[model samples]
Target chain A: MKIKSLTMILLAGTLAACSGTEEKPVDQNTPLPEVETVEDEAITAIPDDVDDGNAIDGGSDDLSFLEILDDPTSPLSNTTVYFGFDQHDVSGEYAPTLDAHAAFLMEHADLQVVLEGYADERGTPEYNLALGEKRAIAVRDYLQVLGVSANQIEMVSYGEENPVAEGHNEAAWAQNRRVKLAYSGR
Target chain B: MIRVNVFFILVVLCGFNAAVVKADLTFVVTDYVEDAIPIAVVPFQWKGKGQLPGDMAKVIDSDLSRSGQFKSMSRNKMSSKPHSPSDVQFAQWKRQGMDYLVIGSITPKEASRYSIRFYLYDVIKKTQVAAYTLPIHRRVFRKAAHRISDIIYQKITGEKGAFDTRIAYVTVEKRKKRRLYRLKIADSDGHNPKTMITKSNSILSPAWSPKGDKIAYVSFETRRPRIYIQEVATGKRTRLPSFKGINSAPSWSPDGRKLAVVLSYGKNPDIYIYDLRSRKFKRITRHYGIDTEPTWTPDGKSIVFTSDRGGSPQIYEVAATGGRAKRVSFEGSYNARPRVSPDSRKIVMVHRDRGSKKFQISVLDRETRSTLVLTSGALDESPSFSPNGRMIIYSTAGTRSRNILAAVSIDGLVHQRLAVQRGSVREPAWSPFSRR
Candidate 1:
């Protein structure tokens, strides 16, 4: 099963890379495939509930947020949330994962997470830094609205530096324009 | 590939052997003027020397050719090497299609000084235009060549030459999983390069003071961006206030008393004046949007900066003391990293063309209200004007996926690329004219 999943991921990567270079004309009739694929991946990755055998159910909370977030097989394992070019608004697609994080933070008073926002290497350095900060702050605000404490979140913006992918193309840029949720205490 | 790598390593190692290692950047003219006047710079005759103090003639030749105003004849193409006008056959030069001729001779004097004599002749008019004899120290021999070029350039073009200047640039090298960033300063002709500061983290936005004695740059050595001023001669650095959020985009005021920096300790990234004398921070812009890359006007009365309050990044101007900001660039949807010209009439930035994906350098004329694209690149940034306001040096992606430095004439007539053998060069700041 693992080998099969790896093969599928490699296939998807190849097709996406080729399509990115060819830049096939999009038809108004057909839906955007990449966005749909991204949404499907995000949806299938997360679990409906955080209930697990390791959860300390004797307490008021029935499930452990940190355990679910740390579990590789869980949907909450995906720590990075991507954004559009020059955009700071969080899309509704990340709602489930953000909800899981908010619940976890609220349950554990000592838990803290750092939202490191980054922008693609497109605009000026200083302005991109501002945009990055805004993206992290936007994520922080959403988490706060979902019941996460303000003190639990710390924001930092790397701007266009420290890109995960190095190419000057859209695929690389998409991977770079993101905010990574780095949780403390392992 | 193996052979090329070996050769590159050897070149870099040789450059690293000197006491003060120099990484010279040679220029390849990518564009030129159509009606460039032809000129010949004869190799200077060196007496009682194993080698001349420096290649004075070659320096002058490169400077003139890089300007796009003149085409220098190669030494191999010249029929004779003349040290003075007495040995010059004007008719021979005219036959070779050269309009002007320059000849010089170098002689060592007492106490490590050199006496130099040079003459510029107008071949078309068949008369000597100017001649000079000066004694200079051995350490300043390269500068002497630039001075000669300056004299010739001013006589011919009736404009001050910017040959005798320095350029401060940033270089980044990826070493395995780590990146090394170095702030390098070099002669304007791309010689005698010395690394001013090297850090394990990132460094950006180097701004040379008006006096050229200090440089202000942003360093992420502490894991957060902080502005620091480093004296050029002594290599002394003083860290400014870090504040809460971002501290970046440091631009020195005209008189060097203040630095316009973008700090986000407040609600948003806004321009703030950090007075050097009093060491106080005075807010300049109060907008909630991002205001960055502030450059002072020549007269020091106003500052032009990049702001996104208009929905997209655009150049805007505000009073130095503080007032309502006015938009300066209207045509482009993405214009940022503004650098005002020495004349205070034009501003340049990394402009993203409307409806296009590529980023390029562009200039805006305040008086004419017209913008001209000066470069064609996938990414061109940090457009800084020369001290004379004639040429602009910027950073662009060159071959091999490396960011190399480039210079373009204000009219976009002449273009030269300054490509290093390794790493990436960026954030070039041309120094003001030296007092000497």
Candidate 2:
């Protein structure tokens, strides 16, 4: 009976050790798969603009610098996109700008764009940072739906740290809450 | 004629019932010590032609109760509502076991102008202990009530009251498509908010000078965030030196000669002290990562700021002349906004847990290096202490999608919300003690 009791204790210790080791390895390894799934879902959500190849083949390689600058229909031109107060949701009026930018991205596959998100100064600095990030991500997601590659675009949230207007009135606030599209690389 | 007499008798009964209802307005102070001094706040007599708008007695009652020093009795047990010290019957209050009785009356001085005369009496001694009169307009009746509370508080505790001071905070209101930014200055108890600065551009980090004559804050008015100092008494402002890169996090020195701020004009953000007397800026910290949120020690010899030069953000202190910064907080992964207490012995900062999920306001004992968490909320930041170092005011969010300014005693016992509406209010900077 004593020998049997000793064997039982030894088996319990080994099982405990095995369980502890198993948990440590699994905990360390599980986050990568979860991240991969999130990324995969994001990729699948991309729009048909990139798949159709109509968005990137429009810009001519033979155009001179002055002609490119003078082109009124160039997607490379700057445009203003508006967002709601304390929110990063793309407004209904600004959807067309994203669509145009997506078309530009499809036409110029070599050109990279950066989305700069800003908030009106009203909330805490840290919260504004997060809000700005949300605004930039929202715009990026919409552009992705238009078939723009996620890798070709970068997003940065300036929060309320940058503003285009100085007035405290409604007009100024509307101007301050925006995401600007800037071309980074040719 | 007989019907008229019957009507008069019914009117008299109704008047008596109204008087009884008015008598129910008494003040009680709870949460006191074992041998707390018993005080009573009598029903504030209306001096206006119309009925009183708000409960003045209740405001005074709660203000004194939250101090944790006085024991106020219930109004139901009061003998009478005396308009002044002469009208008070000392024997009645003495019989009810009240050591002190407060009597006050409001008298209309002019059109919508009123003066509140209040008296504190020692019932046992049968003599008036204190008497004062405050003249106020109809719009400031609540402030007069708080002023009366301050008087009573000072008489009993021998410490000056903070009721008359003001607090400056940032208020964010979202319109249909734009976010509005407003810098509001309100009474210390969060009443009578007046907008000092309003802009669509974001404003943050308001710091009051030691003299309380001017305020320094960060504004994004010029397309980029820059520090601006505005005079409180006069509507004058002065912009600080704007460099090429980042300009944020402004803190005033104790003597008001230099302003400690963070500037990333070079490579990375570092602490810089701008001397007001010389009008010259000097970089105090040279670090690779972010070193911001500079707060001066009371003595003006050292500065305590947040720096991630140690891998993660932690509280560090360096000489005003700038040298090696010694890390003060070691337990938390994130500790920022280090506000030194009035006595300069304790440091209050926002501390984040290991995973950075929960952020709380904590007090670090400088002597022992032991930390005490003062708040348990999900996110509580920007803690500024009252001038006397007895209480701290910080911002926290509750049930709704709004930020609320809250205050608690340094010991974390007394807690109260400052805002009345459901809008977001944050970055509370407490004013210095009133000069009198």
Candidate 3:
């Protein structure tokens, strides 16, 4: 049985490596298949509790909060939060999304997330790195005030090194100054 | 009518006589429109050396040639090689159309030590213009050549020369997998490069202090870039107050008692002053936009920095105490890296011409409000004035992959290129006047 399991792991590694040619070199040394399997099991078990528990009676029967989160048409899945240039202070307009994300974090205590901060490409590279860090810290502080555990979140600052928009115009600058939240672990 | 006719004829006759006498005694004033001095540097004779010293004559020849004030004759055209002014045949040099000649001899003084005596002779005057003997180690033959150039320049132009000075630059070289950045100190002609700091991170913005004993540069060693002052002679380094956020762009005050830098430990990037005597950092500018690249005026009374607070990057001057800043550059859309002249009456900066899409060195006369363009090269940055404030050393690149050091006079007449074998030589900070 152990030999069979080892063969399955090797097959999974081969499939992951074949996904992207640029990422194949990094995948060869990383144990990504094992981590993926654990994540898959956790995601599959979350829906079973939502189907039979208070989530069914807490809202419309057919359109539960969990159902809205999973549906692509729902506003919760399409929400995008904006931050000020070189600032992480949740603007008054973004407070509603912050409250929603805070409720989501409270409902799923086991979910670990990472907040990545970025800056526009105006200042020096060194100064921008520190600015991005402060932006991420500001967002993390707001989330913590909303009762998210500090241990469940990680912060990283990419500075001006990476940009979502490549243009040097004002529209691109506004879009590049942002913090992105991504689920990292179960 | 008859009297008027007589008067006109008399005047014409007198004017004709005067013209004839003036034509006969006319003296051609060649000195008023003289060209650059044409010189020939003969190879030095070794007196007491086991292995003859390096070609000191070639070093001196290149040094003088790069000044754009002398035309060096080819060695093959020389009629004879001389060791001193006495050995030089002035008629032979004059026949070759050379105006001046330089002769020298090297003798071994002791172990690894040598003495060089050289003489500069004017062929036209048939006399020795200057003579000097330099005692130095064998490895310093190039330096001896630089000192000779300085002596000859002072004798010719009545101004202190910059050949003997040194420049501190940041060198970036790639190793196997990582890029190695170093702060290097070398002669102004790019010789004897000594790596002061070698790390895997990027190092930028090297500024020499007033005394030329220490240098301030920004290094990314702690994963975040910070400023550090290092003594060039002793390699002793001290980190400045990094505060809580970002600290960089350190420019030393003329008095050397304080450093003007940009700190964003506050919410926005602003200019700050750090007192070296009291070890206290004070915020100087409270702005929402970026205020960086601080440079002190020669008198230490004011500071000039680049800021986008005016809706674009422009040069602004603020009092050392720091309240309100007045806009100094109104012509260029992008004018950064403002280096005030030693005389404190002008500023040399990198000015971007938006229409032509070129960045060149420009001089701004604070008194006249006039701007003069200095270079036609594309992508010219980092304009640093020589100690005399007559010339500027900047970095420019062509189709080549790396940037090269270029010098241009303030009047836009003298232009020359410094030859450095290394690729990508940038951010040249000219040292202050050397006491030695």
Candidate 4:
């Protein structure tokens, strides 16, 4: 029963997926500069008291912003950013994925998230702790560049203590080195 | 809420709950010096009935053998057993090419007390070099055995022994989908495991105070890392104020007056000395880069730490009161988390050779400015000096992907592993010599 509950907790994110967002980049592989103007409607979400009641299309055919994040295929569902060994810089490939989260966090001004960072089992935990924070900050800086509020984000590092994959191989390590976005109050 | 459980996989051991004795850890001597001193520690005679509380002589023998300096003779190989110097079998032991022989007896005393007596003889010289009778309660018979080993070790080697000391380490286990972390203390030989603290989150950097009475470590109880000083005996802990950012890699000063803590006030982590009595913190370094893993010198003069101010991560020396830092390690691109020797002349640290992915334990002689890589593991880290500065106990990957604690003599001639049945052990901190 306990095992089932923990699995359920982990899969909660994926199960929240349902449909697509309103302002997703037309070309998922488009350059990051073009991705900036993709969220032009985010101006309406700037106010602190913004609510989900202002759906762009309350029509029977349209999905809400939260519903788009709930969609498994939506870019907002890609909350984790993977990194190379000992490297903390966010690469170009993660632009679209992070851009989508940045848009959602801006729309829901009340939502807060903890960016939990981690490292593989190669280096010392102390250095890895520092490295983990750097990775999380990399993700946070990207969000801030897209105009996400500082109060809407928090950061924590687990270093090499917690593992989503329990192995010493490259495949497992590739999964361990990550900065995950944990949304509060789903 | 979307909370991805990000974690690094470590150690695979199949040690499920099973029937066992008190000792949760055991020693397996992997490499022994080919020409170690031939010593015979005969099984001490037990006078009381219903079996002795513990095997006193065996503990002493294991302690000696673990040092990699003595090669103990097996009990079965001995022709006869003697309890005192009067049983002169010096000729027989010399025939077996034994240089030293230790004999002892455990006799019941009044009110649950036991009179433990031991005799150490130089078999080559045919003379009894040392003998002592310890009046110890049966409850402390195991500790008495370690005390006996210390006595014999000091008499022959002329160096203070660390057999009576303890080691603090952190172990993590996967309970279904949850990770359980534990802070454990054990005998120097990795026996009699005792848990000082346990939590569901990560616990990093368990460092022993100079006096060995208490320890400071990092725990993530509130889902954020913070430092806590814990009393080993009482389990009482006081958490340092939760700063804005990371508070970790705590090292107690030599005099046990202050602590060197790595604190990041939402900026780069820097070393700060937190005074215990005044509860005031003084920033020790002003740098825009990472400055952490600060360890004080035995003389309490300078604090050596790992920093990347120069470029790559390397060991640097700075004044305890704050000053311009000088680099200490130059042999490798990666050198951090240095633990100084008892003599204050040598430092053991984790080193990654140039153009290499593996991290091994290496010793740097500050006077000569030379480095010697010890263990040849793919990833050997958390190098801690034994109290006598003869051995280094560190964490290394074990067989089947399990991370276990291993010890190597300073010269790298002898090696041993503290085998655990389950859980991945890391960040092992060998305690200072005990006052007892």
Query: What TM-score does the first chain of candidate 3 have?
Result: 0.59
Residues B312-406 of candidate 3 have per-residue lDDT tens digits of 66789988887778899988767777899888999998777656556688999998968888887766777888887867888776334455677
The single-chain TM-score for chain B of candidate 4 is: 0.94
Docking level for model 1: incorrect
lDDT of 2 by residue, B1-436 (tens): 0111111000111212122222111112212344557888887787666666456676676567656555678788886888865678888888888888887777878777877787888888988879988887867666777788888888867876777677888887768657777887776655556777988767788999998888899876654456889998775888875642356778899988889987653234668788787666676776655577899999999999887667666899998987778999988777878899998999998887777556788899998998888777766888998887877888876555466777766776555555435456788899887664
DockQ of 3: 0.03
Supply DockQ values for each candidate.
0.11, 0.03, 0.03, 0.10
lDDT (10s digit) by residue, model 1, range B17-77: 2333365676667777777779999988887556556667877887887777788887899
Q: What order do you get sorting by lDDT, best first?
A: 1, 4, 2, 3
Candidate number achieving the greatest lDDT relative to the actual structure: 1
| Ten residues in sequence with the least summed lDDT for candidate 1 chain A | A45-54
User: Cα lDDT of all candidates, in order?
Assistant: 0.79, 0.68, 0.67, 0.79
Docking tier of model 4: it is incorrect
DockQ result, candidate 4: 0.10
The docking quality of candidate 2, as DockQ, is 0.03
Higher-TM-score candidate of 1 and 2: 1
Clashes of each: 2, 7, 0, 10
